[model samples]
Target: MHRPRFLSGAIAVAAASLLTSACTTGSGSSADGGGAGGAQGGATVRLALTSDVTTFDPIRQQAASDYVVGRLMYETLVGQDDGGAIVPRLAGTWEQTPIGVTFTLKKGVTCSDGKPLTASQVAASLTRYRTISAGAAMTFGPGNTGAGTTITGDDKAGTVSIELAAPWGELLPGLANSTTGVVCSPGLTAGDRLGTGAVAGAGTGPYELVGAERGSAYELKLRKGYDAWPQYAAMPAGRPAGTLRVSVVRNESTLANQLQTGAVDFGAFTGPDAARFGKGGFRVEAAPLIRNFVAFNQREGHPGADPKIRRAVAQAIDANAFNKVFGGTGQVMTSYVDAKAPCVSTDPSLLTKTDPAAAKETLEGVKIKLVGSNAVGQGAGNTYVQEALRAAGADVQLTNADNGTWATQVMGNQGDWDLTVFPMIYGQLARGGVHFIGDEPADGRNFGAVDNKAFLAGYGAATTTVDQKAKCAAWQKAQKALLQAGDVVPLATVNVHYVFREGVSATIPAGAFDPVTLRIAE
Candidate 1:
């Protein structure tokens, strides 16, 4: 996701320079109609979302929509405020030691099922995630292969202990993620049944899921008898305002039209639609999104296996051109970390810039195939890359892979393609390679299968380092190996834009991706 800036002459010119192709008005008040709620009992706030949510079960779902919906259904041990600081949620307070960290559960909290929330329940949830099948385990850590940490629960004392092999200063922040939301044992057993049809989790949140229809819509009702709502001392408006009715609309055009007609109070917009919204009187906001890049499948023994070929591909493509084509919404990143992250590299020279002559010389006799998803932006980006590589004197072919089969095809080496475009779904972690790239099976997201001892050593040092600067330096060294080796090419960091009505007021914090705060007015 890229930050949204006020449109300037330079930005407008940059956007106009990019290959580009490709709004509405409305007012009414029904849960089904697109207007502000009426001043009556049982009103619902409708939100039209862009992505479809795959699953309500947090442990098994990886989609951003799932995380957003999960926020409505479950409560994490900790949550980030509008300022991006870790604040109390399910857990009131926490303390850490060399061995592990302990969190004290808040008193008198109850799940949707009316069960008393306790540390035992939170520990049980974590244990279940660690022990469950592959899909579930992958949510908590690197992969679903094995559990590297242990969690203990003391119900009576209302405390949970998370033990790690090494010091994990980011443990609290990590736990604050939706994947670690506490769940009652019954809720776990019931699985996504409630998530599919009704509010399931025993959360202390303001709203509860009443009905969900997979890819269609999710209906959330006010949680009656809930007392742990955030205090709004200044405004004194009704908590949560009212029930939230979220609908998944895949078509950006239709979503824009709906928002304009007052069919939906809020909606998400991207690409060309962002500009359209700005011109149409809608408020557009941007958030930090996972960086998208074209990764050379090192596992595939082909031209990509050659460092020169990979470097050639990286040097040939113009990130600025690609971003321009895609509508200059994101930054061309050098490292995996988002610009707002503390671990981001400061040296601008580290980033790859367009160099056609250098690229041509490097790829003199190379022939490569580039694989990418059939998804919209991905396909466009891949085509631009293919053109760049062709211009650099390499024979490249573009091939399509469905999202579900993409990872499998790359891992199985079934295709003859030398490079594949893959989004670093894990964001900053993708660059750190702490859990994805190294000596161990867990060490490499380097799907290209390239392993350098020096890179692995640097990664190990970075993960164990306590000082922020030192850790950044160590990670920088590790990145240098990946960049220098050209195992994967860093492209532009994609920016996601959310469009809301004029009356709505919100801001996306620096590090967070989702735009949940948009629902809250100042």
Candidate 2:
């Protein structure tokens, strides 16, 4: 979960980028099929990326753009399908054990370096990943860290076991995240170089990084005889593009324009530019990208420390009105988790209905500071929020910073802001629990300094339970606690639109497209 710019799970304004790690919805394909194998499959598929990746190290990736490149270069042990159900990838099969999960490797899977992918290498990678100060591993168990996890590999048995110090129902789904991508020994040896895009053959996916031009484009070529494709039921029966030229086109209009001119085979858009290709011709796959919500800082001396003030701020704004800013292409959220996440609450009582009169009465004369990431069209939403609070008689100040600054100041808890319309794409409740249930930031990425006993209790139950019905019930309780306490306000879910040229198609899950699922006609 990096700084979300649309597809990632950090924070975003709208459907900002393309492809979530594994979850997506809707299907878009072309009837014009390409010839079989060789030249056709050998053809280069030019795709569009809204931003450039800061690193190639999957473990250290922090933005949606980074995932765009990482997904193509790395493969996870297990994968989630369109329905967010666990499916096999590098691991041929897996089973839940008392402590954690054990996975048996698929015999033929090889690293990009053309060597056998050993369970020892996978175990070592996971071991190293757990030690990294920040990244998905921290959230994989939702909050468990190095002190609470262990990994072991048995090459003779072709198995790898991940044992958690505590019960975590999300162990499988967490491993499916792009950030948990298993790296080869070469990649682990590369160390810091992995973060700078200087290492190759560190991944176990279909493509290998061959060239990179920062802020411009990345070049990758398909691995010959690569056969570890995830057997997603809806995957188009076609070969992967022989070559991938991922061009960085930061503008939505430019990405849409490129799709129409045959300059790029595929690109995702979440703004007005999406309307340009909806009438036919281009293939389109759409999915709710991320759930945008309102979160308040509860640090002492802050306006948000009082639940009444937080509720008043929540009531001042309308989720429907906010959704309209993105052309009403998203669903109004009823809980902190996105609609796609398992155990997400659908209880309408969890939200406070718009009541400007009550809000104005409570918030009048209150001074507040609002912060947001300037990525995509987030500023427009920030302006709307500013005006809403101002109209409520509160002296509101809004600051829109670049994704980096916002993540550092706001997400890193270095700023003095009171509230934010935060957006994220975490695919599971447990995967995102770290944000709502701890005392300090180090405990659970609780940047707001939230201290909710009820929320933590509910979260504990949900993560500890293996029963689906019980888990969902516990999750609902957790969400209710957050909403009722005014700790977080659910808003809406923005949809990411993947528009593709004819003869090329891809499946979109949840927030983003799976690069391995990409199919191009020869």
Candidate 3:
């Protein structure tokens, strides 16, 4: 899924520099959409999309659209504000203890079935997610595959216990992941039927999924009397008047035409597509998306396994060359940690300025293959990387997979490709500090093979350290170690672009829009 930030599952190829415009909203209203519910009775917000949501099942879905749509149907136990602060969601209050963390469910919350949302359901759902979903490994602590982290529901106590392997950081952020949203046992117990069969889209969100035609359109109706959102006050608030119709239109030009003709009110655009928008009808806003990368393979026998070759690849390519691909619209990435994150750093070790001579010397006839999502940016990147490697004296080929297959193909290490332009589909990274570096490769999350004992040790210290400076220093050490290892290279963190009708107002975080807050102009 690099994400709907690029789909967000291993999900996308986006993130660049910013280009802001006039806009305002409690939930991110933009340039006077007649101030939220402007229509007399209500308004149906039409959203045009570039791709169908990869999956609707919170547990199995990893794409950015999945996360965005997931929020519309489900609610996270914790959610981040625009500034990325962790706030409560399904769980009203949470307290940490030496042994584990305890979360208290909010009272009176009900699923779409009108059944009371219970602590038992929440606990069982997490357990079920571990068993059925690939996201169990994405939860930031020792996952289901690892020892130590465990979940227990005490309905009598009216609380859910999230006991960690041992006080791991990112516990809050892990729970906050949209994939970790609470669901009733029926939804979870219903199995594959819940995701694809009749029971698909069942959840406890402010809106209920009414119908969906795969790769065509999705319809969501407001859950009337479901106005009590978990974090309404911190961000924008809105109750759309009518059903929300999400249209899947992969063609950029056709989608632009639709927006112009008023067929849809919103559309998230690619950089080039956005560049074509005139000043009047659409609102173009650019914000930090994600750190993009050309990740290398580090497992024992790959070309990237050779640190010199990895260094060569890193030094050979020019990230700035990609700016032209975005229509000279974004920043070239050079770090793993998002610059917008509170933990931003300027460590020199993470930087990758190209040196053709060094790259050529390192590669000098080495053979490799670069695989990427069939995105324009990835295609350009494949070209640029292939050219650079060829110039640096290596043999490389470019292959593009359907975007749906991209998220998994890069991670599967299926013995076909050697490198990828899109980095990992990441979320809530800073909280846990360095789990991504140490996650087991088999979990599918660990695409780059990193086995630095020093970094792993620093990751352990990061979990327990109370002081901010010590934690940052520990994280810095880990980052440097990974960079020096040559396999894990950092590139530009750029802004992702999305376009809205002149009157639509919405808030975006890391290239993801908060579906609950979307408001339409009359």
Identify the candidate with maximal lDDT. 2
Candidate 2 Cα misplacement greater than 4 A, ranges: 1-42, 136-144, 193-201, 212-215, 376-378, 442-444
Q: Estimate each model's TM-score.
A: 0.80, 0.87, 0.80
Task: Pick out the ten consecutive residues of candidate 1 with the lowest summed lDDT.
Answer: 1-10
Instruction: Give a tens-digit lDDT track for model 3, residues 1-522.
Output: 001110113333121111111122223212122123332214555655555677767776644456666777878776665444555566667776434578877667778777777788888888876666655654545433445567888887678887765555556556666777777766876766666622533587766778888887777766645533545333433435356666655566676666667665566555566665557767776655555667777677778777777888889877777555556566554456555554455566466668999778778888898887765465665676778788888888777776666655666555466887764435334532343465544553566665678767766665555355776777677666666776455555444566776666666654456666665444
Candidate lDDT scores, in order, read: 0.57, 0.73, 0.60
**Candidates sorted by lDDT, descending order?**
2, 3, 1
Candidate 2 vs candidate 3, lDDT winner: 2
Clashes of each: 21, 11, 36
Of 1 and 3, the candidate ranking higher by TM-score = 1
Ranking by TM-score: 2, 1, 3
State, as a TM-score between 0 and 1, how close model 1 is to the true structure: 0.80
Writing each residue's lDDT as its tens digit, candidate 1 over 1-522 gives 111111101111111111111111122212221112112213445665555676666665455566666665677776543322455666766776534577887677778766777777788888876676343323333422245678888989988887766554455446656666666776667765734544355554445676667777766665554443321111112213345666665577776566667665555544566666675666666654545666765654677766767777878987788777567788877766556655655465665667899999888667787887655365677788888888888888778766555655664445566787665544444234542364323333345666666677776666554456777788778778766676557777666666666555333444343322333332
